[model samples]
Every structure is written in structure tokens, then in C-alpha cells.
Target chain A: MKIITTVKELKEYVKNIDKSIGFVPTMGALHQGHTKLIKQAREENEIVVVSIFLNPTQFLKGEDLDKYPKKDEADKKICQLSGVDVMFFPSVDEIYTDDEVSILAPCVRGFVLEGFSRPGHFNGVLTVVMKLLNIVNPTRAYFGKKDAQQLYLIKLMARQFFMSVQIVAVDTQRESDGLALSSRNVYLSKEERQEALKIPQSLHLCAKLVSKNIRDRDEIVQKMKEILNPLELSYVEILNRNFEVIKEVELGNSVVLVEAKVGSTRLLDNIWL
Target chain B: MKIITTVKELKEYVKNIDKSIGFVPTMGALHQGHTKLIKQAREENEIVVVSIFLNPTQFLKGEDLDKYPKKDEADKKICQLSGVDVMFFPSVDEIYTDDEVSILAPCVRGFVLEGFSRPGHFNGVLTVVMKLLNIVNPTRAYFGKKDAQQLYLIKLMARQFFMSVQIVAVDTQRESDGLALSSRNVYLSKEERQEALKIPQSLHLCAKLVSKNIRDRDEIVQKMKEILNPLELSYVEILNRNFEVIKEVELGNSVVLVEAKVGSTRLLDNIWL
Candidate 1:
């Protein structure tokens, strides 16, 4: 597996290849979730290119910008084991410059859920994603649904900008006990780890309620709030594919999302109905 | 020549072409200046794609977006005469959606000169340019130095975004009397047209002064201002390629720019030293 660092070198490498490329961009903790995305990319394309960069712009001033998890050696091994053709490891300077033009997230959709909790987060994600997409010039790029809003915003960006690459949304990977896998999962204490399970449990309860013909959004949300009782809840939203809130759940077209704080760590989980 | 009205059609046409594409994006009302850019693109690449989009975002609320020149049939004829391979003409609705992601101009550089006079103008120009560039996916794009800041900002955007297309800057096309050609020139009445001559004359005088070893920026600007006296001057400053104000004119690295209002129509002219 080739390990590329600079933008110029990676671009040159992509330019010479005649085959279709599949890209999976990550911040690199080499968790099971990342491996799942890499595996899907590897299966679908002639070449799989994975990127591991802890983009600074996505984090707010007080957020975990400095302490975001990093496991570079393990991440390299994971990509090699998952059959990634190239692992692009660009420095912050390679991706960003001083006082450059920036991308702004959508006013409404980009400010809800994760965007609300962390304002300007999508801007950083989008700016970096655009840079990476242009650099890799992949045929199709894979993004896990774990960062659901990020995936939606990326799709919106692709359509809005008329980018050629297909954005493929992968299913969210989860732990056996139903905690959705996240790089920040490491930040959870033993007690917090158990509390994190409520996130998925609330989402599952929403799914179960929907299956039982409970279609009203308020009732579903009310039941969900109860399931998420005692935790510092950020939001529990029921929205359509476009992120617009719907009064009633429409199966296959609805997404029920939940976000709550587990001790000092914030966790989010959702189910597409 | 194929005329594409939809983003989907343009993307489809570009996808089938195996040859290199050269693009020139315009807002219709094609004049000698636009033709010069298109001609350069046609000569330099296997295919030439020109877009006529009157992007609304670039215009401030009270600006000439409504009254701005539109010579659609004439523009089509000019492109046909100039051997353009594809002409993309998209509607406002087709180009923009509700509360979409946007491009913000550079904090400092984007707010000076043209950006200073027309705040958020480069942001609009860049947002549309980025969209069009992605849609056409050209090999090399062409822009006239007539709109010097626009060209510079675009080159900056291409580099900053890691866009692979080469940006070829064409020389400023001018009238016999050195009045820079512009679509807005049509708005100038007969007497105003004569007054516009001083805009370029001031730039030329700066060049002549620089040639005579008039290296002081203030001295050069002062001389140019005397020549531009009595006209509503927007700005008459000199700066280097990086848009930094240099005390002394550095030949081959400096640009002398002038923006003056000939009656109500604002005209911009610049000379690369």
C-alpha cells in the first residue's frame, strides 16, 4: 500500500490511474466503523483511497480540537489489512492556507442537530471534504451514516456544486451492546460507556414504536425522551430525508435522531425508518 | 455547437468528451473582452465550453442585477462565430436552491479594491465559478485581466480548493482609445463613454511614470489622481501580485488599478507593470 502525504503527490498518483477510485475519508482512530467504510470502498472500486487527517476547522474553539483521538500506526495497518490502495496523510498546511476562501453551511439544514450543538462544524467538514474530493477525484466516495448530518450536507454540496463523484452513504457500524461506534467513544468512562447505550436504545424504541403503527412525531418523541430520561439530552428530532421536520412518521422516508450527553461525552444515534 | 440549458445536460456532454476542455464563464452580453477570453480558450484546448449565467448572488441588493446587460441571441451568435463547442445557459432556478451552501470571500484580500467597492462580490463570483468549474470539469479555464481582482480571486480559488484545472489569465482587451471593454460599457452614454477614457488613461499614465523611474506608490497614485480629477473615483491604488500595497512599484510584480464612475456607470481599469 502506498502512503502519500502531500497534495501534489496524491494528485499525481490519482492522475496516472485509469481505474475507478473509491474514497473513504476519516480522522483516523482505526475503529471498527472506519474499517467497515474502507471494506465497502475496497469491494466496490478498482482502487480504494483512504484519508486520515484531523481537520482543525471542524472543531469549535472550546471543543476537543487538541484532544481528538489519533492512532496513526494502527490506522496504517487497518488500511493495509482492508486492501486500501493508497493512504493519504496530508498535514494541516497541505489542506488549508492562511485566510483562504471558505465554504458556509446551509442556513437552515446546516444549523440543526449536530450543527446546532456545534456551530460552524459542517463548514469545516465541507471545506475539507471538498479539498479531499478534488485532490482524490474519486469515482465514488463513501461516508458512514454515523455522521448523518455530515453525509446529508456532503450530498447537498455535491449536488449544489455539480461535483461528478457519487456520494455513497454506508450503514452505521455499532457495538454489540448497541452503542454506535465513534472515534470519541474512547473518551467515555466505564460508567459513561454504560450510559452511552441509552442513545441507541432510545433510537431502537423509536423504531419499535414506528413498527407498532405509532406514526405521530410528538408521541414518538415523548416516548424517546422518557427512554433518554436523566441524561442531558441535546435533541430528539424526527425529520424527513431533507432534514425537514414532519408531523407524522413516513416509513422509509423518515429519520428519527437522538443526541444526549453521557457524563462529559456527547453521543448521538439515529435510525432511518 | 451544442447549447446546454441544464446542469445534467452539460455534465453529460462534458462526460462524453475525451478531449481537453477550456472554459470561459460569462454573464451574457458578450463584448470584445469576452470574445478575447473565449478565443484564447478555443485556441488552447481541444474543446471550448462557455457559460452565460447572470449570477444574482454577486450583485448587491441595489446593484444593476436587473438592469445589467443581456444580449442572449447576440451572445449565442458570437460563441457560434468563435467556434465554441458548448454553450451552457442555466436559469436562476436551475442554478440556485433555497438556503444553499455558499462561498465567503477572503476576510482581508477579498474586501479590498473591487471587493472593497462591491462587498461580497467576489464571494458570489467564486461560488458560481466553483459550481461551473465542477460541472464542466475543464482542463484549462480562461479569464481576462480586465477584471483583475476577479481573475486573481479565481486563481486563488482554484489553488486554494486544489482544483486541477489550469487557470490561464488573458491580457485585458481594450478599445482603440484604451477604454477597457466591458458589458457595462453599454450603460455609458456618448459623453460618458468619453469620460471613461480617463479611467484607462490614468492606468497608462501610471505605467509611463513607472517606466520613468517613478517608483514611489504615493507619487504614482497622486499623478494618476490628477489625471482622473473631477470623475467620481472609487479607487486608484497600486499593489503587487499578492494584492499587498508596495511602497515602490516593483516592475513585473505590480498592478496599477483604477475604478471611476463615468456618470452612474462604474468602470474599472488596471495595468500590470
Candidate 2:
């Protein structure tokens, strides 16, 4: 595996290659979830490129920008083993300059649920993702649905910008016990980890309710809150693929989402029916 | 020249073409200035594509968006004669959807000169240009130096976003009388047209002063303001290639810019030393 750092070298390298490239962009702390994305990219394309840059713009002032997990050495090893053709690990300075142009999320869709809890978060995510996408110039880029809102917004951006790359949405990789995989999962203490399971459990309960023909969004959410009981729940939303709230779950077209605070750590989980 | 009206068709058309493409994006009513850009693009690349999009976002509230010039039939003829391979003309609905991601111009640099006169103008220009660039996916894109700040901001955005296209800046096309060619020149009545001569004349005087080894920026600006007297002068300033205010004119690296209103018609002119 070739490890690339600078933007110049990556551009020259991508220009010379004559193959369909698959890309997976991640904030480095490569776990099974990220590897799932990389492995899929490896299997699909002639060359797979992975970028591991912990973008700082996505974090708000009091958020965990400082405390966000890092496992650079392990990440490099995993990318090598996963058959990554090129690994772009750019520095923060390489990705951002002093107060340059930026991307702004939509006024309505970009400010709901996750966006409401963390304003301007998607803007930063979008800004960095655009930079990475332009730098990589991949044939198809993969993004895990663990960040369903992010995936949706990114797909929206790609379409809105007329970008040529295909944005492939990968399923959310999860722990066997149902907790969705996240880089922030490490921030959870032993007891907090157990409390975090309610996030996924609530989604599972919502799914079961939907399967039982209980289509009412309010009732499903009410039952979900019971499973989420004492935890500080941010929101339990049932929205269509368009991210608009629907009165009834429309099976294959609906997404049930949950976000809850387990002590100081916030956990998110969703089920796409 | 083939006319493409939809984004999907344009994408497909660009995909099938294996040759290098040069692009020139315009808000119709093509004048000598636009043709010059297209003619240069024609000479540089194997394929040449031109877009006639009157991007509404670039105009501020109460600006000339509604009253903006348009000569669609004439523009098509000009492109056909200029050897354009393809011409994309998309409607407002086809290009924009309800509430999506947007691009923002830099805070400081974007708010000076033309941006200072019309706030948020560069943001709109940058956003539309980004979309068009992505859609065209050309090897090289062309812009005239008449809208100096616009060219600078667009180049800045392409670099900041890591876009692959090479931005080739073309020199400003001018009339025999020294007036810079602009589609908006249609707004200038006979009297206003003659008054507009002061804009280029001031720049000419500034250049002559600089050529005579006069390096003081304030002194040069003072002299230019005198020549631009009696008009509603918005600004007369000098800056380096990076758009930073320089005390002394850097012979090969300075730009002298002027913006003024003649009988309610806004005109812009600049000279690169």
C-alpha cells in the first residue's frame, strides 16, 4: 500500500492512473466499521483509495475536537491489510487554509435532528468532504449509513453540485449487541457503554412495532421513549428518505432514528426499514 | 454546436467525449469580451463547451437580475461561429432545487472592491461557478480579466476546493475607444457611454504614472480620483496580485481598480501592471 500525504502528489498520482477508483473517506480511528467500507471499496474497484484525516472543522467549540480518538499506526496497518491501493493521510494545514471559502448546509434540512443538536456540524463535514472528494476524484465514493443524515446530505451535495462521482450508501456496521459503531464509542465508560445500548434498542423496538403493523409515528416514538427510559434522549424521529417527518412509517421508505446521551457521551443509532 | 438543456444530458455528453475540453461560462448577451474567452478556449483544447446561464444568485436584491441583458439568438450564432462544440443552457428550476448546500466567499477578501459595493456578490458567483465547473468537468476554464475580482475569487475557489480544472485568465477585451466590453454596457446611454470613458482613462493615467516610476499608492490613487472627479466614484484603489493593499505599486504584480456610477449605470474597470 502506498501512503500519500501531500495534495500535489495525490493529484499527480490520480491523474496517471487509468482505472476505476473507489474511495472511502474517514476520520482516522479505523475500526471494523471503517474497514467494512474499505473492504467493500476494495472488492468493487480496480483501485481503492482511502483518506484518513481528522478534520477539525466538523467539531463545534465545546465538542470533542480535542478528545476525538486517534489510532494512526493501527489505521495504516488496517488499510494495508484491507487492500487499499493508496492511503491519503493529509495534515490539517493541507486541507484548510486561513479563512478560505466554505460550504453551508441547507437552511431547513441541514438544521434538524443531529443538526439541531450540533449546529454548523454538517457544514464542516460537507466542506471537508468536498475537499476530499475533489482531491481524490474517485469513480464512486462509499459512506456508511451509521451517519444517516450525513450520508443523505452528502448525497444531496453531490447531486446539487453536479459532481461526477457516484455516492454509494453503505449499511451501518454495528456491535453484535446492537450498538452502532462510532469513533466516539471509545468516549463511553464501562457503565456508559451499557447505557448507550438503549439507543440501538429503541430503534429495534421501533422496527418491531413497525413490523407488527403499528404505523403511527407518535406511538412508535412513545414506545421508543419507554425503552430509552431515563437516558437523556435528544430526539426520536421517524422521517422519510427525504428527511421529512411522516405520520406513518412507510416501510422501505422510512428511517427511524434515535440520539441519546449516556452520561457525557452522545450516541446515535438508526434503522432504515 | 449542440445545445444541451438538461444536466443529465450534459453529464452523459461530457462522459462520451475523450478529448480535452475547454469551457467558458457566460450570462448570455455575448459581446466581444465573451467571444474572446471562447476563441481562446477553442485554440487551447480539442473540445470547447460554452454555457449561457444567467445565474440569479450572483445578483443581489434590487440588482439588475430581472433587467439583465439577454440575446439568446445572437449568443447561439456567436458560439456557432466561434467553433464551440457544445452549448449548455439550463433553466433556473433545472439548476436549483428547494434549499440545498451553498458556497460562501471569504470573509475579508470577498468583501472588498466589487464585493464591498455589492455584498454577497462573490458568494453567489462562486457558488454558481462551482456548479458549472463540476458539470462541465473541463480540462481548462476561461474567464476575462475585466471582472478582475471575480476572476480572482473564482480561481481562489477552484484552488481552495482542489478542483482539477486549470483556470486560464484571459486579458480584458476592450472597445476601440478604450471602454471595457461588458454585456451591461447596453445600460449606458450615449451620454453615459461617454462619461464611462473616465473609468478607462483614469486607469490609463495611473499606468502612465507607474510607468514614470511613481510608486506611492496613495499619490497615484489621489491623481486617479481627480481624473474620475464629478462622477459617483465608489472606489479607486491599488492592490497586489493577492488583492492585499500595497503601499507602493509592485511593477509586475499590481492591479489598479476603479468602480464608478455614471447616470445610475455602474461601471467597473481595472489594469494589471
Candidate 3:
């Protein structure tokens, strides 16, 4: 697999390859969730390009911008094993300059859920994703459903901007214990790791409730909150596919989302019905 | 020339054309200035696409958005005569939906000059330009040097977002009496039209001063203001290509810009050294 460290080099490399490319953008420290995205991209296109950029702008002033995990060597190996055609690992300087144009996520959908817990997070995500998408010029881009809000926003951006690439939303990958795989899980201690399982567990319970025709959003949220007892819950929201809150969950068009603090790290998980 | 009014139809039309597209985006009141941009685009690429979108976002509240000139029949004839292959004229609803993602211009370079005078102007310009660029998927895009700051910010957006299209800057077109050609010039009464010539005339004096090795920015600005006397002058400033105020004219890198109000209409003109 080819590894690129600069935007120009990556674009040049892409230009030489005449194929339908699939792109997967991530923040590095690859986990099972990231591999799922790459594997799907690999299966769908002649070339799969994955970008690992720990963007600084997405993190707030007091957030983990400086201390965010970086497992570069391991990330490269994972991409190589996952059949990635190119690994774009650009430095902050290479991808961004002093004062440049940026993409802002949808004001309502982007500012709620993940955006509310961490304001301006989706702006950074959308900005970096746009840069990666333009550089890769992919025919199809893969995004996991694990980041439900982000996936929705990206799809919205692609449609809103008239970008040509097809956005393929892959299903979220989970651990055997039902915990959603996240790079941040590495920051969890043994006890905290166990506590993180409560996140996905509550989401699963919400799904089970929906399956039983318990469609009331408030009831589902309350039940999930009870299951996530003693944890610092940020929010438990049940919204339609458009990210609009609904009184009753509409099957195949609804999602239950939760964000909570497990130890010092924030964990987010959601279930699409 | 084919005129498409919906985004879906335009995208379909673009997909079938297997040629490099050169695009010129405008607001529909075709003047010598706009024709110059369209004419250049026609010359450079296999297919030329011109979009006439009076993007409301670019106009601030109470900024004459409703009264912004629109001469559709004349513009269509001009495009046909200029050899444009496609004319994309999407409605506001067709181009935008409720609560959409937006493109934000850079904080520094985006908010200088015209940006400083009309805050959030570049943000609106960049956002719409980004949408149009994505929709057209042009190989080369044409922009007039008349709106120097707008051109610079668009170039910044393209680079920052890693868009592949080459941005070609066409020189400003002018009237016989040295007034920079603008659709807004139509709003000028017979008296206001004569008064508007002072804008371009001021830039001419600044250019002569620079040619004579009068490098001091303030001195040249002062001289231009003398010629623009009795007219309501917005600003007469010398800036580098990056739009930062410069102490001395760095030949080949300086721009003399003037913005003035002729009656109720605001007009801008610039000369690039």
C-alpha cells in the first residue's frame, strides 16, 4: 500500500490511478470500527483511500486536542492488512494553512447531539472530510453508522454541495460484549472499559423496546437513562432520520442516541431502527 | 445552449458530457464585465457552463437583494452568443433546503476590504461559489479581477478544500469612459453614472503614482481621495495580493482598490499591479 504524507503528493498519486476510488476518513488509532469502514470501501471500489488526521480544530479549548492518541505505526499496519490502496497521513501544516476557508456543519443537526456536547466538533469534521474528499476524488466514500450524526451530516453536505461521490453508510461494528468499538476506548482503564459497555447496552435496550412496539420517545429515553444510572449522562435523544425529535419512533426512520461520560473520556453510541 | 433550472437536471446533463467544463457563475444581469468572464471560459475548455444565481446569502439583510438586477432574456442571449454550452439557473429552493451545511470563508483573509466593509459578505460568496463549483464540476473556472477580494477568497476556498479546478482570473472590463462595467451601474441615474466614473478614475491615479515609484501606500491613497472628492468614498486602500494593508507598493504584488457609493448603489473597482 502506498503511504502519502502530503496533500500534493496524495493528489498526484490519485491522478495516476485510473479507477473508481473509495475513501474512508478517520482520526487514526484504528480500531475494529475503522477497519469495518476500510474493508467495505475495499470491497466496493478499485482503490480504497483512507486518511488518518487528528484534526485540532474539532476539539474545544479544554478538550483533548494535545493528548489525543496517535498510533501511527499500528494504523499503517492495520490499513495495509485491511486492503487499503493508499494511506493518507497528512500533517496539520500540510492539510491546513494559516487562514483558509472551512465547512460548517448544518446548524440544527450539527449543533445538536455530538455538536451540543462538544460545540464546533462537526465543523472540524466536515472541514477535514471535505479536504479529504476533494483530494481523493472518490467515486464512493464509506462512513460507519457508529457516528450516526456525523454520517447524516456528511450525507447532507454531499447533497447540499452537489458533490458527485456516493456516500455509503456502513453498519457500526461492535465488540462481543456489545460495546461499540472506538479508538478512545484505549484511554479507558480496566474498570472504565467495563463501564463503557453500559453505553451500547442501553442503546441495545432501546432497540429491544422498539422491537416490542414501545415507540414512545420519552419512555425509551427514560428507560435508557435508568439503565445508564450513576453515569454522567450528557443526553439521550430519540430523533427521526432527519435528526428531528419525534414523539413516537418511526421504524426504519428513527435513531436513539446517547452520550455519556465513562471515566474522564466521553463515549457516544446510537442505534438506528 | 441548454438552460437547466433544477439541480437534478443539471447534474444529469453534466454527467452525460464527457468533456472538460469551464464555468462562470454570475447573478444574471450580463454586462461587458460578465461577458468577458464567460467569453474566456468558452475559449479555455471543451464545454462552457454559466450559472446565473442571485445568491441571497451573499446579500446581507436590507442589502437590496430583492432589487438586485435580473435580465434573464438578455443574459440568455449573451450566453448563447458567447458560446456557452449550458446555463444553470436553479431556484433558491432547488439549490438550498432548510437547515443546510454552509461554507465559511477564512477568518483573516475573508474579512478584509470588501469583507470588512460588509461583514459576512465573503462567507456568503464562498458558500455559493462552493456549491456552484461542485454542481458544475468544471475543469477550469473563470472569475473577473473586478472583485479582487472575492477572487482571492474563492481561490483560497479552492485551495483550502483541495478542489481540483483551475481558477483563471480574467482582467476587469471597463466602459468607454473608464467606469468599471457592473450590472449595478444600471441603477445609476444619468448624474450618478457620471459620478461613478471617479471610482475607476481614482484607481487610475493610484496606478500612475505606483508606476512613478511612489511606493508609500498612504500617499497614493491620499492622492486618489483628492480625485474622488465630493463623492461618498467608502475606501481607497493599497493592499498586497493577500489583501493585507501594505506600507509600500510591492510591484507585481500590490492591488489598489476603491469602493464608493454612487447614489444608493455600492460600486467596487480595483487595479492589480
Best by DockQ: 3
Chain B TM-score list for all models = 0.98, 0.99, 0.97
Which ranges of candidate 3 are over 4 A from the true structure?
none
Please state the CAPRI-style docking class of candidate 2: high
- Candidate 1 segments exceeding 4 Å error: none
Interface RMSD of 2: 0.7
**Against the hidden true structure, what lDDT does model 1 obtain?**
0.91
Measured against the true structure, the TM-scores of the candidates, in listed sequence, are 0.98, 0.98, 0.98
lDDT of 1 by residue, A1-273 (tens): 999999999999999989999999998897888888888888899999999999999999988878988899999998998899999999999999987888999999999899999999999999999989999999999998877889999999999998989999999999999999998899999988987888898999998888899999999999988988889998999999999989999988988888898887888788888
Residues B1-273, model 3: lDDT tens digits = 899999889888888888999999998999889888987887889999999999988888889899988899999999999998899988999888889899887888877768878888888898899999888888999999998889998888888889999999999898889988888888999999988888888888888887788899888888899899878877788889988888999999988889888899999999998
Q: What overall lDDT goes with each candidate model?
A: 0.91, 0.92, 0.89
Best by lDDT: 2
True contacts kept of each: 0.85, 0.94, 0.99
What is the C-alpha lDDT profile of model 2 across B1-273, one tens digit per residue?
899999999989999989999999999999999999999999999999999999988899998899998899999999999999999999998889988799989888899989999998888899899999999899999999988999998999999999989999999999999999988899999999998999999999998998899999999999999989989988899999999999999989998999999898788899999
* Chain B TM-score (model 3 vs. true structure): 0.97
Better of 1 and 2 by lDDT: 2
Q: Can you tell me the CAPRI class of model 3?
A: high
Per-residue C-alpha lDDT of model 3 across residues A1-273, encoded as one tens digit per residue: 989899899889888888999998888989888998898888889998999999988888998778888899999999999989889888999888888788888778899888998888999989988888999899999988888998999999999998999999998888899888888888899999988888888988898898898999888899998899989988899899999989999988998888899889998888888
Tell me which of candidates 2 and 3 scores higher on lDDT. 2
lDDT of 1 by residue, B29-118 (tens): 999889999988988899999999999999998999999988899999999999998999999988899979988878888999899899
